[model samples]
Target: MQTASRRFDLSVQYACNKEGLPSRPQFRGWARAALEGGGQVTIRLVEAEEGQELNREYRGKDYATNVLSFPYDTEPRVFGDLVICPDVVAREAAEQGKSLEAHYAHLVVHGMLHLQGWDHEEDDSAEAMEQREREILASLGYPDPYA
Candidate 1:
């Protein structure tokens, strides 16, 4: 677990040609807000093809998803990667009536939480994780993503 300092090393990689992706600073801010300890996190934004490939290869899902967390380590210091599909995010944002920035922030926080070992496989766990997301996003001045 991390100490009070909560320092982290963050890298942002854009593999997609999206026109309006979030900036590196924005990614850092969102990831920092969700940090529970020292960590090295990489955020990769990919095109639909790569997104679908990763989802299929890693999660066995054929379609592209909004975000995926790949955590390698969590003890002493955290190390992980967050793969995000901007196209999927944009589509979901339009469908959910959320701003792109807000939706990105929510996913970043959600992925960070997963890197820290949070799970939503069960009803109880899902409720708790969603509540924590609400609190974190609220603190960041974003509306409830679940609403």
Candidate 2:
């Protein structure tokens, strides 16, 4: 039998001045759809500068990308934070011909999976994660993000 998926306590923080960002409920719904167990997560919407600083400090990258997931604890519960740069998301959405909401949904799912120990570090692992992402997004009525 399948174990019950744990519920999540999610918070959305806006650290940027970007317009057209999604609301807290939207983020919560997306997170809920992706999270597989009991967890607490803070989804912080940041500007490019903060995003760049975080990437530099953590991943040794010098520029901002899209979404970053920081998982703190895992066991009976999962705790983490998801930092997302709206500027990058918007630019990527425009460039990829996808809606802003679609991109955000994809990133939220991706980050939540990371918090659950899902990774794409290897070729086979990447394929597995991508397949799972595709399934989750499709359940949420989104088209293939990789398509």
Candidate 3:
């Protein structure tokens, strides 16, 4: 539970260096958009092993997906952490024919929205969240992820 004013703070790490990770400013820009009024967040980039471990331990998924959102507080100066797996992101980007940076931006925005009380558990909620994500991603100059 940390807090900061209208600013995006990110700390990135790598469990491996197979894929080139996004820059700090790139992450800040993406997260800032999702914050609405801006806020502080930590973006941790890991390899597949750590990502899989986190997903398994916390989400009960045996394999790693993409981004994992961990929000701490939101009342005053929204705070949260985003765990991103570079391996999975790169793979997905290649499979989906998207640039690495674009995928990272999408995930960062998606995670930030989740931090601020967004969910995709139900069809309605999922559609709403995806639309929001689409708008944000589009604004960030990325094509629709679902398309």
Q: Which candidate's TM-score is highest?
A: 1
Candidate 3's TM-score: 0.89
Error of 3 at 99 (Å): 1.9
Candidate 2: Cα lDDT at 86:
97
**Clashing residue pairs found in predicted model 2:** none
The digit string of per-residue lDDT tens for model 2 on 76-107 reads 77899999999999999999999999999999
Candidate 1: worst-modelled 10 consecutive residues by lDDT: 1-10
Off by over 4 Å in 3: 1-5
Models 1 onward score TM values of 0.95, 0.94, 0.89
Give candidate 1 regions above 4 Å deviation: 1-5
Q: Number of clashes in every candidate structure?
A: 1, 0, 0
lDDT agreement of model 1 with the native: 0.93
In terms of lDDT, which candidate is strongest? 1
Error of 3 at 125 (Å): 0.9
lDDT of 2: 0.92
- Candidate 1 lDDT score at position 34: 87
